[model samples]
Target chain A: MTAILLISSALFCAGVYGLLSQRHAVGVLIAIELMINAANLLLVGFGWRTGGAFGQSFALFTMAIAVAEVVVGLALILLMYRSRGDVQVDQATELAQ
Target chain B: MNPLISAALVALGLPAALALLLAVVPKLRRTGKPAALLSILGSLLALSAAGWLAATWLHDPKQVLDLTTSWLPQSGKSMSQVGVHLDGISVSMLLVVAIVASCVQLFSLGYLSDEPAPALGRYYAYQSLFLFSMNLLVLAPDLMQLFLGWELVGATSYLLIGFWFTRPAAGKAALKAFVVTKFADSGLILALITLVAWTGSFSWNATLPAGGAEWLALFLFIAVMGKSAQFPLHIWLPDAMQGPTPVSALLHAATMVAAGVYLIVRADPIFAAAPHVRLFMTDLGAITALFAALIAMVQTDIKKVLAYSTCSQLGYMISGLGAGSLMGGYFHLTTHAFFKALLFLAAGAVIHAVHSNELSDMGGLWRKLKFTTVAFVIGSLSLAGLPGLSGFYSKDLILEAVHESGNPLALGLLMATAGLTAFYMTRTVVKAFFGKPSHAAEHAHGPGPSMTIPLLILLVPAIGLGWLAGPMSKLYGRSYAFHLDTIGMVTIALGLGGIALGWLIYGMGLLQALPRAFAPIARIANGSTVDDLWALSYSKLGMGLARAIAWFDRYIIDGLMNFLGWLFMWSGQRVRTLQTGNVQDYLYAVFGAAALIALWGGWR
Candidate 1:
């Protein structure tokens, strides 16, 4: 159990760093999926220890959200690539000007 | 119900109707002679009506005819009424106003007939309006009606005084007259408010409330002083001579100036209730009479001399009213009307002939204008209170009243003022008529019959009105016999002495001018410095105050408003920068806030 916890913590930290620093649009989307799965693993682990089904249910809910997020994110990247011919995460910040 | 009532109404209504018709009818408004003729006809109708009312009132002094109709319908309170109260005083006032107005209009027909200006229609219209307002002023039953009439007369006088608006002096003089009278008019407003608040009624029949009765009397007296040209307020009348000559005769000398005296006589009960107020009025009257008389002596302009004399005579009437003799005051007001109007009209005729107002430019006109000379001499005699003249009868009564009131100071000042009146008038006559021909007088000619007729008609009243003093005194519900009282003797001697002194000086050239010892005192009394001070206070001081207020409003009030506006604008601009329209930046901010919150929660 301790080993699993250590691995999941490392995964969450790596996912947060990638999500913030990634320059490519698809790379950022993959980092968000990684972060969501890491959260789901933590939820399942805690649920098994606490002898409750609540954590497993929440993990299920998070997994479904992760799938929906990837779908919308890929669509955004497709739109950006079609418009600019290069889907860079920095180029998506038309909001900043 | 009463014939006098209808006569009074006609006296009040005819002039108003004609003025309205002339003003509203564009066709009638375009013509000059027709307007003058209509005005004269209306004034004559008013004269006949006023004459009938006077004759009726004279037959029975106690008869008071009140005619009223509901003016404003109110739900809770009893409604106010449009009304006229025809009594002895009102009848007498109406008669004097009508007679004088009739003569002035007749004279104006000639004065304006030859005038090259095309605006004579407006001139006659204003004259008619003035007559209407004055008649309304005399006949009004309530304080409200009196005030309305008072203000109407003031406005009409303003219009007439500025009739020749092309001249700068005429315009300035009109403004000065209006402003000064308006300042005094506020006193009437205050008096009305006080009367209404205290007595709960605006009727003249309402006895004044007891608590602030003296203050109310003072307010009314202040209004009278302003209208009558008492001491401090006499400054306007001399300047108001810039108006047309007939206007000066009708309004300034005959009616409007006397309106103040008429008010005191009408509101006698109120003044009687406040002895201190009466004393104050007496002092003001005495000071104005003496001061104006002295000023009249120094004036070089013929009309200015008459203007000051009118002021002095009005002072006599006011002082008489203050001294508790309604008969004396009203009688003087009546007689003064005739002589003063006569004097002004005669002066107008002389000016007409010589085409000048300065005494320096008028001399030896007696030979050229024989009828005007006779009229002027008779008017002068009446004014100087020579025995058996109208002014003697009235001036003696005023002196006796002041003496009987036991105000030694007022009596002395008034008697001395009487002497001064004679001196100045005699000096004016000598300088203008008896001396060698001046450059202007060299080309002098007699005025036409239209002018001469009014003068001749007024001369009869100026001479014979003194004998009517016995009968006229009875109009005030008192039987006064003609007798030379001690004060009467003193005024008589002083009047003769004044004329003798003037004859020795100007007629015979016995002295160069008023004694050299009088130079400094004359300089002070001549009103140059006082006039400057008056001009400065109203113009310079008033402007300074207004500018200071404007500065405060701009810097202090507007500064606060602008500062708040600027603060809102600056903060809005700063807050707008946060809305950078960047989706990534917004997401970053949300996540950073969420992370900070999570960290704080874990620590807790």
Candidate 2:
């Protein structure tokens, strides 16, 4: 369980860095999902180590929320993509002051 | 007799039910507006009943009515709850709302009679909705309910102001009205959130720590500042005159503008505890009163002039409440509604006859529209703070309260402003009504009884409502040994003098003999700079707020949605490439992904 937690932390760090540094909006979104999943895996690992069922339920609930988020996020992304063709975040300068 | 339920039902429920009736009935389609008018009549009876009940409660000071129901009981300490507590403050506001709502409906009947039947129905719906929100605002027991009601009133005003949606200018005015007040509403919501976090309850009865009270007061003041159109944020009211004149009578000139003062008065205990906030209210009130009055002096559009006067008058009430004379503020609010609505509806009648809002395009309306001219003059006299009029009582009470405020300078300047108010209001009367017929009024005539009757009814209070002051002072001002003194008589003399001077120069052609100090000042007082400012304010800085809001919606509000779409397309393109319109390729890709997942799981 501790080993799983240690591995997931590295994945989470990589995911966050990718999320911020990427210029393409799609890459950024994928990286965010990766980061969230990594955190979820760490929660499951902690649940195993602590022998706490509460932690496991929390992790499961978090996963459900993430699924809802993805569905909403994808719908919105489709709207944006149709409005403006390029997926690059910098090209989405329609909102910029 | 459950007076609490009955009053609350009348105050809040009747308008909503009436609006619903208008919506559902088909055979009543032609009767839509009369139904709307009757709905407000229902409000009048309900309001009279509520006022009687409230008066009874006031008579028996020990009687307090509480209406409570569980809101969020299961959420423990974090759960939200609300209590509906009816007292003198609610009674006062409820009475004001009932009176103004009824008049607006009566005024709308004539205003809308010429319109297509369907639009009139919609107009009544808007009116009912407005009354609903305002009534709720008065009876709101806690910060949460209060804000909900507050927001609803603000929204109704915007809708009604911009009710002529086909006109670009009307739509623009409505949006400007909403965004500007919303700027203040945000501050208000923030203050409520802060109070909830710190005190664990969003209610007036729940006292906050001293520091919290001060912070909350500052936030509430910012909101009242915007809502009541005090300094800087006031740019919306003059432009708001673009709506139909009945709407202008209802929202811009009367009850909607008073909601801010009602809010501060409703939250008096919170304000009273914060000395700084109370002081802020006083200063804002004084400055706005003087400033808006100055602008009103220059407005050539008759409605625009009245709009600025409404702003100035509202400023007076705000300051009165701020001066620790909550009762004085409330009194001024009541009287201001009577006269302001009278003025606006009278103005509406004049505009209906002449087919214009521009005073420059109207003159000698009195020869034609006699009752309108009379009603307008009475309204003007009240507005000018004449001695036997409602304005004098309320204005003097504010002054006396300011005297009690321990701020001699504020009181003095406010008194001087009384003189200024008289001068400008008299100017409006001279330019609009008491002149040779301009082109518009050349063919003008009096409006119908439906219009003239409401104007006359308002005069009941406008002419002598101030006489109630001595007893009211006793009822409301126990802390101060109040006396109705002759200090206002001096102001009255000056007001009459201003009217006479205006009558001579503008009305009777005595501009030829005026002293230079009053001359160049009076000349510039009626100059183009004032119109230019009114023009700028009326145009609402050319749609800056709407552009900003739309920009926010496109960017911050919609950004996340766009990002996800991109992610889906990118992944879908990669995944779909493998499908290749071939069943073999799909199976192979799926097997490959499963094998890779199993390998990764084994390694981990």
Candidate 3:
């Protein structure tokens, strides 16, 4: 359980760094999915240690939500790439227009 | 409502309705005939209403009719009222205004016939508006209503005086008349506010606070000095002759100018309490009378001569009122209205024929215009105060009033002014009517019946209105005999002597110009020096003050506003750079702020 927590914490930190440093729209989406999965992993580890199914069930629901979020996120990135002819989020800077 | 009140309402309302109709209906406003016919019909209706009101008042002279409704209600009572106040004074003034206004409108039809249709329509609209304003003034129940009517008439006078607004001189004269009167009107405004503040009502009969009457009277008299065209302020009036001649007759000579004296009569209770102000009024009136008459003596324009004579005549009315004789002042106002309107309309006829206001361009007009000549002669005779004329009766009463006031100085000045009035009028008659025809007069056309009829109608009152003085006296609850006293006899002799002098110089050509000894007096009376002084004062003092105010506004006031605007704009530009439109940058800021908040909470 301790090892699982360590792994989840490392994964969350890596996701945060990727979100801040990424210039591509798909890269930001993948980083967001990684942070959600890291939280789900911590939930399952806690459930097994406490011998309660409540944490595991919550992790199952979080995983499903993460899957749905990734699908929507990838579709938006695909549309952005089609419009701009590139996946770089930094180039699409004119939010006001 | 009383029948007299209804009559007064009609007298006031018809012209207002006509003016409104002319204003609101574009189709009606563009046609001369409809506007003229409507204006004449409205004025005649107003005249009949006024006549009926006067006759009813004459039937029962003692009854004072006051019918008012709450205009501005406050705390279960009215602060001001709108209604008719028909006493002898107002009724008489109403009749005078009605008569002069109707005659002037009739005469304007012919006088302005040559104008384009739209311009003619505008002229009649203004005339109807003037009539309404004058009648409203005559019928006002309180100082508030009076001031409203007063300003309305002033505005209408401005519009009418600059009726031919295409002419630069007409526009300037109108502006001069408006600004000068408006400056004096500040006194009236102060008096009204003070009266309302102290007494809590705008009624003329409101009991004033301690020592309020004198100041109020003095303030009202200051306004009178401007409206009545008294000395110094008399400058605007002669210039106002730049308007059409009928405008001069109605506004300057008869109704609007007499409003000052009428105000004194209406607010007699206040004026009666202020003896020092009355004395000031007497001395000022006397000086204005002599001064304006002296100026009238040298004027080359027929209308200018009449304009100055109006100032002189107004002085007599003011002096009579100042001497505590309402009968003298008001009766003179009645008679003067008729003869002066007659004179101005007759002058209009001559000007109409010759197509010029200059006396140099008019001569031998009597041969071409017989009816107009006769009318002009009768008007001039009445104005000269010849025995058995309307001017004789009214002028005698004023002199008698001044004599009784024990102001020998005022009496002397008025008597001399009477002589000068005759002299200038006779000089005008001889120069314009009797001398050899000028080049313009040789081919002069005669006025149509539209012009001739009003002159003929006004001639009756100009000749015979004096005989009604005894009956007119009853309206004021006084007795006036028709007998000539010693003072009356002396005034008549001086008048005849002035006529003789005028005839000898101009008629007989005994003198080519005024004697060299009188050059300085002539130069001063010619008005150049006084006019120049006024111009200099206005350009130097008035314009200088305006410039300083403008500078303060542009720099000090505007600078503060500009600084506030610049601060907002500069801060907005600095704040706007945060919006780099990068998604990762916004995400970094949100995470950083949340982390800092969580760290602070944990530490606490």
Off by over 4 Å in 3: A1-97, B512-515, B560-604
Q: Lowest summed-lDDT stretch of 10 residues in model 2 chain A?
A: A88-97
Question: RMSD in Å for candidate 1, one decimal?
Answer: 3.5
- Candidate 2 DockQ vs. native: 0.01
Best by lDDT: 3
Q: How big is the positional error of residue B222 in model 2, measured in Å on the Cα after superposition?
A: 1.0
Better of 1 and 3 by DockQ: 3
Q: Of the true contacts between chains A and B, what fraction does model 3 have?
A: 0.63
Highest TM-score model number: 1
- lDDT for model 2 comes to 0.76
Instruction: Residues B1-604, candidate 3: write the lDDT tens digits.
Output: 7887888899888999999999888789899978898999999999999898888878888879888889988899889998889887789789889888999999999999999999989998999999989988999999888988898899999999999999999999999999988888898998898888888988778888767899999999989998999887888899999999999999999989888888898888899988888998888899899999988888899999999999999999999989988888888888999999999999999999999999999988899988889999899999999999999999999999899999999999999999989988999999999989999999998999999889988998999999999889998788888877999999999999999989998899886556454567878777666777888899988999899889988988998899899999999888777777888878789888888998999999
Candidate whose DockQ is highest: 3
* Model 3 alpha-carbon miss at residue B128, Å: 1.4
What ranges in model 1 sit over 4 Å off? A1-97, B72-75, B116-118, B513-515, B580-585, B596-604
TM-score of chain A of 3: 0.84
DockQ of each: 0.32, 0.01, 0.44
* Pairs in steric clash, model 1: A95-B581, A95-B582, A96-B582
Model 2 C-alpha lDDT per residue in residues A1-97, reported as the tens digit of each score = 6689778978876776676567666676787788888988888888888896977898899989888988887777788788887566545544322
